[model samples]
Target chain A: MTDLTLTPVQTRQSHIGKAVLRWSLYILLGVFALFYLMPLFVMVTTSLKSLEEIRTGDLVALPREVTFEAWRTAWSSACTGIQCEGVRPFFWNSVLIAIPAVTLSTLLGAMNGYVIAQWRFRGANLIFSLMLFGCFIPFQVVLLPMARLLGMMGIAGTIPGLIFVHVIYGLGFTTLFFRNYYVSIPAELTKAAKVDGAGFFRIFWSIFLPLSLPIIVVTVIWQFTQIWNDFLFGVSFSQAGTQPVTVALNNIVNSTTGVKEYNVDMAAAIIAALPTLLVYVVAGKYFIRGLTAGSVKG
Target chain B: MTKWLEEHTPKLVLAPSFVAIMIFVYGFIAWTAWVSFTRSRLLPKYEIEGLIQYERLMASPRWETALNNLFVFGALFIIIAMVLGLLLAILLDQNIRTEGAIRTIYLYPMALSMIVTGTAWKWILNPGLGLEAMIRGWGFESFTFDWLVNPDMAIYTVVIAAIWQSSGFVMALFLAGLRSVDQEIIRAAQVDGIPTWRVYTAIIIPSMAPIFLSAFIVLSHLAIKSFDLVIALTGGGPGYATDLPATYMYAMAFSRGDIGQAASSAMIMMMVVFAIVVPYLYSELRSKDD
Candidate 1:
């Protein structure tokens, strides 16, 4: 058949056709890349522009002259409903909330995951299943009750209250991450460590903990993103001083202040988004690994 | 004493998390379920009434809009995101050299908070100096992309922003799925003179069924839980025209002090989730047994 061997001109023509097709694919992908990147580009450029320029110039144009005035105002002096303090205080609030919550959940999850994966204890599978189910419930179902519970614990409207809520809600995902990661590890390691007369904590400490660095990084990054970007809990469970950056950013953008400063709003948004974006850029593979592991397992 | 400690220590380590889940997650769900049946108003009422709040919720016009919008939004979001994601994945799988950088760009939006996504889109769709203005500046004076301000068209804007945020995620899932298919099978098909399109449509796509389900579950779950994006983009505004159930529940409980309505709406949301998730979980666990 003609397909058995191509003539020279035919080969040349087919190569040309293939090159055209490949270029078209790249062009299509590049177009979509622009679609996805456009908003971020606009956000950055608009944040750097003067208000006058934003009003007069094209939405996607490069700024005529970059200015940091809006960034300064958004960070330190913009009004977010009765409080002239910008999102700076609330930005720190998110940091404070994310750090402890990530640490506590990851540690607890490691221990829980280790026990469930290693021991095969009684009722272990059922408890793990129930915890896994807990991950999928709409947070609205738990919002009212969590608010009341936090109030009863005397930590309502406080950073600790928000932290407690996150760590509790975050338990299901963190544990799932650790448990799945631990399951791949052979059981003989634990059995050998037990033969060394090491107790539960000792075996976990010397063997599993050393090997848990990957999962720990994954869990910490996952928890930090969830807690940092949280808006519902931050809005519902927090008061003025304790609200996280997300709630504050919402207030600032939606706040009916003197003038509608689009530049300031964009800057505040970029600020609120910076830390998680940094994590995503630096450790994206782990981020994707966490996402697939966490979502698909459920 | 030492023997008892040795035997019970693992359970001891897990006890706190176990108890916390039991109390905070399950126990709180029970509490919310109980409140949904009551006449709770400004504050929660302990005495349970019979279906009154659910009755009110069903009868309310806004709740009707919310349910209708959820149906519309959920269907479109899942379908479009899957199709677009699949296309992007196929294109990216062409053995292109810029795959890593392009993948990063596509997924970077996912790293952003929905609030940020909303903020960015809100400005872009501002009707005056946003997309409309830009197009007008480009000599298309009659052009209008004012979906943000038009009550009937506002929910679609939310869908657009949501797709922008999530489709890349679906692409990542599909790319991984596409890569996992056995290359030898594809090669054999190619050698059999099957067209590239035929090989994909008949062999590759169908084999990625599990990933399709996973993507569906994730997208639908996200659609149901979507609150921040709606709040930030439109504030469920133009007369509550874009109210999802989550935003409706928030308005009722926190804004309007109608806890009963909030509780009922929350219950309905859980039911919707349970309908989707229970079967998925059942299959997941059953397969695990094999």
Candidate 2:
């Protein structure tokens, strides 16, 4: 009976059927890919079209007269609030906020992770646990108090204030990322460094830091994308002149006073999105690795 | 002194972040909880009252809509993303030639911010300018896809945009989980005259429970904190038809001068997060103990 099941006459027919099924699967995947890429295609084509062409054209049509005018306007001339200087200043604001936030948070997290993973002092687990909870809590829970704190610090509505918030909130994930990576390193490495009379800072600098390239890449990309893409903190903490690119993008697109410049809106959206998109396209493998690692550990 | 320093260096390194989190995370949570019970408005007041803000929050029809929308959006977003993501993962697991390209395409959305996703989707969903117009131009004059403007359907538009952004992420997670499943067991099952589908259903998928749980936790957390997406896409508009608690809290505190309302809403959001995360943490820590 088992032999009959294995050598059934249906095998020949099923082979062809499986081929058809496989092709259908490919087709289905192609359709889904189209769905995923459609908005991007629309954005690109729409951004390329002039206002007149956009009005006359369908969303899916390739631009009849491609122009960089929208791009120019989005970058240099578009009004985001009262400022007609376009998304430039806001773009720089985001850069300012993200660079420092990413650097400080990653450094702090590395130190925390090293201590928790290697040094293992008293109450270390408790500290790690408490920090990890920060990763999961809704930011609303802290927004009011954080606003009050930022105001009290007299840094409210400043880029530095936004950076502080990002760093504080970011500590949890960065710590988790580094701690997980460091946990896999053998304790003997640290012990050897200690035997050679290396202090904590020395061992970390010489032994651990060099070995952390992979995790650091993961950590940097994660932090860069996160802080770059952050909107809530950007909107809440910073106002007009200091607002990040995200807040500017929101303002530019959602502003209701003027003619609805869909083309400029699309272009500005692309500009706001370009950095992280570039990161993903360039280092997608690292991004995926970081994502999976973060999810799995959680 | 050297020995003491050696013993204490780790603690010293950890102390700053420890203190910051204590004040920033736990401390703020406590303060927000305290603020929720007061009658503060416009600015935070320290006068302690009892449940007036909560009572007002529960009374507001907008809050009711926001809570209901949260449940509806959360449930649909989680379920739809999981199903779609799993299906994509299973398809890609067939070892197709285009796996790398397709996976990259799917995962790219996750890299963009909610603002970008919301903006792009807004353009595509705009009634006269987007899908509706395109379909209408394609000789389907009666066809309409105006969920963007319809108040009753606006929240679903948020759901659609969110699933578009996140399903790819969930797919990557599931694909990773699917790849790590032992193949020998599947081959054994196949050799025993079991069908391929049966092997996957009965053996492979059962082992992926932990991934599903993780995905659920991640998606739920995202749903609760869904502020930026709503802001960019709908602005919780058409008369507050799509106010998720995050947006509600923002509107209350920043725009409406209702600090107490914001605090209460924020506390409710935290409670929702705790409801989901606390049990998951308990299980995780207990499992580690085992």
Candidate 3:
């Protein structure tokens, strides 16, 4: 309609107008990109600068003299508390905690989701509804009871205790991801497997699990991010030696007695952030799938 | 035994997770709810006394502040994140050349933990050495970005970092929703000489009601459970001025030795979540039934 109504000169003017609009859109998008990148920029720049330079120089300026001292300290020697061991132990602590928790939760959730979606027992829907509602409750509600229970179970303030808590809370989400995915898979495949006398684990292992590669990736990424980035459980359930990197990072930055080592704090923050950042950058498609597919923790 | 096992295998596999959830999710909620009614302080007292803890919670000024902050923070965080996220999504949808890089930048913050976000913003909002000092360095002597230290404006700073952290994900959500809108409808509307803005308002946005609701649920959920950010950024201070309920409960339970207060606050928080989540779940389940 615009082409039909416009003369030759009018079309050329409209072309220029559209060009301006398009460029302005790009500029607006670029500005937002800058806003989003600002903190990461500040962290990187501040981390690379010396303390003397950080104090005397601009907050967001590129470091005139770049140094890895802050990174070294943050990784190996920054004082998180009375302990000056840095976030290294806590970083390894997170790795240990996240792996078993992620694996166990993904496997358990896959089984639970498989049954609910395909096997459809007499009361499976009821069971699922019970479990599904569990996902949205704020962890604060569960913290006190879980603390006492962990103490009773004699795993309180330990790494295994943290893993146990994550696996338990993570079930609802893991089950959900698998259930929805398996539900999309045609029921006939499972029926044929069952008809051929393939048992429960057999059918799952040979048939469903083979088709489950994509969902497994999604579930693994989702649980890894949630468990890795977890602060509430990490802070509450673990003792000094068992603390995760996020808690350690918090302590390093917020410990009030020292001269505030802004560079070290930024480095520590980045170190804590690097794992999930890598996941988002490398396999962002699956990460986004997990995010949208009811990994409801924010 | 093997034949019997085959019949029960699905239930057998589910039994462990089911029992754990029952114990942790439902059972612990019951335990916490019981504690809220007890006189437990500094430890667990299993005896149910009444609603004394709730009365105490309602009467306390700090709890009042926490509740008020939740209202303010929840509202602003949801509204602004949604608006800004939708704006970003719409802009990114316009056949932009570098959309992936921009989307990745926007969504990367969600990958980082709240503690990281808070740590960065904590420095950026620092009064003496942060954005303020940098701006002052540019020859303006009167710039003050002291919300990190100011009592009244502290909660808003958390809101800022939170919006930065979450709105990108919301953009991703809305962008997905925008892309899923029927292209044919949009094409037809454009052929009718309707403006792009009109097409969005009249057709595209209106079709995103479900995504809008889901985003609201997600953000409000984030707001209610916000603890790490507050702790890292403000530590619920300048005298607990920025205390959200989650932080308030933590203070009462672990730091202040008021387990009863923690329990009661926890119960209230659960109630708030249930209030929001149950209906959302109900509607979602109902729709899935179709």
Candidate 4:
């Protein structure tokens, strides 16, 4: 009875304890942050150092002098095969493939999401469920058949074919995101629009589309990163001259018996990663907001 | 009429994507299934040999190697990825400083292609050039980290690299889940004198179960399909010790010119994935319905 009556005093003491506990959590988090950041530190330092320095195993040591020679070599003169040209040629190809693939996939995924969420259609659940199930199947299981189908269509080894492939595989996640997001929006909004004599296409284009910016950004960033970093389909579908930057990077980095250019490889990696990293930094808030929105809104 | 139109509109809207998927995706899956049944060579032939490809698949040394390696690698990859991912999420959820920086650093690997990241890990794990040599330089003359060269230990190395590459995505998924957990619950637990670890293990974990399961399924699927890392890191070498199903399928068709065998291997992989996926998916649907 006395303890219950003196609960305020107990609460004050607990507050102080909680404050201390929170500070300790901050400290613990700092340590983990260091662990996650260490590899990137090594990568950047190795990229800046000369091959001679790297070979001498001074990885953690500050470079004698920072140089961009490795970057220059990696971008221009590093040998992927008999040719001495670096990863430049593949950059354009990757961009070309990525842009169309990302745009088309996002558009289709948005439509899929809009329809499934807004319209109560027969077989909609089944189609959506099948797609979701398809997402679980390892893509490698389908690659052989996909390749054969492409060959039959005479688009095997073509960029369009590769784009089609990425879009198909990307559908599950994109549609999942959009559908969930659309679900979160009040059906009243669409109802009001319908009451005002708005049709499906108009409502989608004006109302739903504008409201979908966050998810669209999420879809774009996700798809861009995925298509840009994709190696298997790029390599499997396209040959040497038409290969993406990933394939070029692979050919350069994975070459056996060639002189190992550790500095060049690191530079190339950083270069390849630059676009997505930049996007993430620029849209850091949106990605998290988008994720939160998709969940909470739904 | 209105109800009929409402029901039919979604189907019409979804029809193009579905048809495209069926033709390009499921159609190919069926075609591959067919190829698996035939005794095709190189670029898939029409010669029917009934179950010969399956028998060959059952007997092939490489196929067995791939299957065994994938099982071991897949298990390790999923377990480690989930553990590390959950841990990172928990740590990040503490309202820490430099949250964005840490998240970005962890996620940067996923931004790079496997070719680049896998090759980097290969270099870092290489006995002569990486951690081993670095240790020797530090006066440990007896130091040896030659797992990359050892047939038995090679797959473990792949797991290490793969975990590094994938754990970040899991972390991202988990962090989102953790953030969404009700703060009121944590406050209540705190007021009740429950320890933070106890709260996490008891309240937080259960609440985050669905998202964690989703992340697990995603990571496991990624592990099962993992190909590029294996190719870039070991090339399935050191006597095929690091081979995975994807690489094995590719080798059979492209390298060995045995399309029938490759298709069979692919079919086997599908069956394995289907076995794991179908039941889980069914339960997921049922749960959603409820």
Candidate 5:
């Protein structure tokens, strides 16, 4: 490759230059990685420090005395509002919201994908386009009316209300994921099933569903991170008792009146971020695939 | 009956979702538009009025500030993120040994929520408690990095935090785009004795226009709906100096109880989104038809 780019007279100089370029590239990547990892490093060290150490020590220094008290307090006893019960309840609220929301949205997307891909009817493209538009609209556009609609349904400010909102808003991306995945699948399998007297549900249940594991993983991880990290819907729809972890983390970090415990705040931020971070670490390849699949094709 | 059910099963499976989106997504947009034209206060009112809320929105200084901040934040955030992301992608494309570790480190931030990003940056940028103090303690007694508190500079802190969180995801997108470019083209350019950088500049980057557009669309949308980051970091603070439309809308609706203002602000946001998105979608769908 180097010889292809360089003439014989320039070979030695070009080899030296290429080596220089290679090292420079590594240096550039190193600098960027440092910049990217700095905040997480600070958050971890700060969360581990005693409050006294945080107050007195250098911001970048390792904690002189490591402690897990802040994590414990953030999880069990930090006051966000009138309740001093910490983020425990809100964490559960997020779990409740995310589980059903991811499950329902993924299932609905699979079904929608199956129909749109295999059982194409007239106007299916139109319906898919309409749903695609749902992905782009700013959520602010629906806030007031959604609040009103939730009120009318008598589930406003509840965990169920938050779940419904996530599932509804999530349909676009989930459907897009499944539809794109299913479109790549050959149509012959479904057609063959039809000839064997298999109906829509049976063909989908036995064949498409089994074949959908990869896309389903992508969709579930995508939806799980999205719904779990959601703040707008969580903050807008749910109140004190049912607020999700993201909202609670915000309130805990931003609440004014008491002495600001930087350690506790850092711990709470890490706590709020842990689940998604874990998913990314364990399945980052799938996460990247999902992200690229969603954006690159659009 | 069997025949009818067979024919209808797919439609039956699709019906609930289609109806939900028709109402929850499209229907609510219409409702918000209607409410934006009304004189609603703490609660929504159905009575029709004519642009009164918009008139108020235009008159309010806070709304103006939010719009200006959005423009500044959006422009800087998008441009910087794309450039940095492209640079990182180009660097990673050099076939470095530590590419996987570095890529993972860069992309990890995107996995976490904006709220987490905001809080971490908030502490990092805090004048008395964070960077300033740390630098001062290192014997640079006169050093200061206090954008987190300065009213005029607070919005840029949001910009900084946003770029940090998103540039990695942008890199991932661009990296994928870069990798997909045919190796044969580079070989051809190499045979012509073109410099490596020039080959990339002239041939490679130009071919990734679609990826560039996709990144722009995603980043701009995230910027436009930037409520959580602002709320968690600055709370549009130093007297609303950092308010973007998203945070402004939330404040008006949830805190100030001015539902009319919220609705109008939201409509304006939606208009901004539509202006950027609809044209792109039109071109995309049109091209697909051919």
Candidate 6:
């Protein structure tokens, strides 16, 4: 403030410079935002167009006659095969699978994180390290064996099979999220709870759990997106009847010999992406915060 | 009794996740390793088949193509994402208005599944109905943008889509790092007549090295496991031009009914991942020791 008041010429020069910079920043950011949004913009426009317009390939043009038929078709009437049931049935299955998968995995992950970050039990660190290490292992390395094992358990191709897979993989990051968060939490809180004769579960349930809202939101959003959008596991672990929306979307999009239904494909993708996109828009700040804090402390 | 219960409480807390992960993840991975050496086809069979699967895998042109494609894809995806992410983060740090909306726009793609990403990008890049057609419609008949259909340039098209999808995540990481940097450093650099770009290039970027490495590792893992996008976009098409290792393994196992060969390909991928990850893990683990 003092420096600006003392230098009139410098202040005027600075004002002009600042004005130039502001508009330049706006223009630059506006351009990049379009780049960021191009695919989505194209998809939505195409989805509103008729099949003839899509095949004619004037993708950037405003539709001659915009229609919601593709959305209607993709949601309720498009064929996965001979069924023509669209993707509606699989939406509930996705919801059902996602709910429990998200719940159980997150609860267990929080508990594991609490125990790992707080308790110094023998071999606990080793187990936690191994679990974290598992985060790096790719799914391709486990698909065959998991198939065989799930077959042995008689759980292959079941919803339970998919839930079980989500929980297992979800542990890597969710537990890491909770664990790192718990580390950042002052140990005095836990120590005080223990001094009050609280057991492990009691302390976690009361003291730690209440303070864990941010991480819980993070895990829920992450797991929801992951399990909902998952394809390989959904396709591999489940039979045709039990597959999720991702598989149905794939089948709709990838029926090689049939004419590609660009409109319906775009609509279905928008449908598939809507849930997570909504979650992000509503809670994106905490999402970034959770990731930042979790990464730094972890 | 109290001592025994106290001793076992953490185990109880951890038991459910521990057992679930071991059985599903580690145990299944072990099974994958075992199957690679067997004569299984379309399913797992436990019989000693020596190294025949490995021999078959090595002989397959498709496997080689997938492996090379992963390298090309991985390198480009990481490099491009990092560069773009850092630049975006720096620009956004200029105290720009509408920062929230800008951030949301960048990160929205990360919210979508790769299936959606592939679908959306495929439409955008499709030679018949996408940018090429749109451009041609503008009266430039010679404007050729058919890389999605070209076997040679198909992989780069994948690279572009992937960079768009992932740079936001790297941006978030870099954004966090940039916010943490001391304002004093910027002031000092300005006092010394150092340009803002040079100061960022020389000082700020080096300071964000750890954040960069972590983002790099995460993206690299994603690149290795990239199947959904390939499935959605090209389907490894125009004659398997963009077939990545994970997709190749899926094809071998499910489409070709060669579980043994698939297992071999998966093991090779795991080995590649391990080679990259082990040293990284070692360093991360060692850092805490210091």
Interface RMSD (C-alpha) of each candidate? 0.6, 0.8, 1.1, 3.0, 0.8, 1.7
* Residue pairs clashing, model 5: none
Over B163-187, each residue of candidate 3 has an lDDT whose tens digit, in order, gives 9999999999999999999999999
The DockQ score of candidate 4 comes to 0.49
Cα lDDT tens digits for candidate 2, B233-257: 9989878999999999999989998
Instruction: Please state the error at residue A279 of candidate 4 in Å.
Output: 1.8
DockQ of 2: 0.88
Q: Give the runs in model 4 whose Cα sits over 4 Å from its true position.
A: A1-31, A285-298, B1-12
Residue B9 lDDT in model 4?
Answer: 67
- Pick the lDDT winner: 1
Q: What is the TM-score of each candidate against the true structure?
A: 0.99, 0.98, 0.98, 0.89, 0.97, 0.94
Output the better candidate (2/3) by TM-score: 3
Quick one: ranking by TM-score, best first?
1, 3, 2, 5, 6, 4
Per-residue alpha-carbon lDDT of candidate 4 for residues B167-281, written as tens digits (9 for 90 to 100): 8778888888888899998999998879789999999989998787777666766777888889888889798999998899888766787878877888888888777667767
Per-residue lDDT value at B65 in model 1: 93
Per-residue accuracy of model 4 over A56-139 as CA lDDT, tens digit each: 855566788898999999899888776678888877778889999999889989999998888756678888887776666656
Best by TM-score: 1
Q: Output the lDDT of residue B118, model 2.
A: 94
Docking class of 1: high
Task: Identify the superior model by TM-score, candidate 4 or candidate 5.
Answer: 5
Return the clash pairs for model 2, or none.
Answer: none
Instruction: Please give the TM-score that candidate 1 achieves against the real structure.
Output: 0.99
lDDT to native, each model: 0.93, 0.92, 0.93, 0.80, 0.91, 0.85
TM-score of chain B of 1: 0.99
Ranking by DockQ: 2, 5, 1, 3, 6, 4
The residue-by-residue lDDT of candidate 2 on A189-270, one tens digit each, is 9999899989999999999999999899999999999999999999999978899999999999998888999999999999
* Candidate closer to the true structure by lDDT (higher is better), 1 or 3: 1
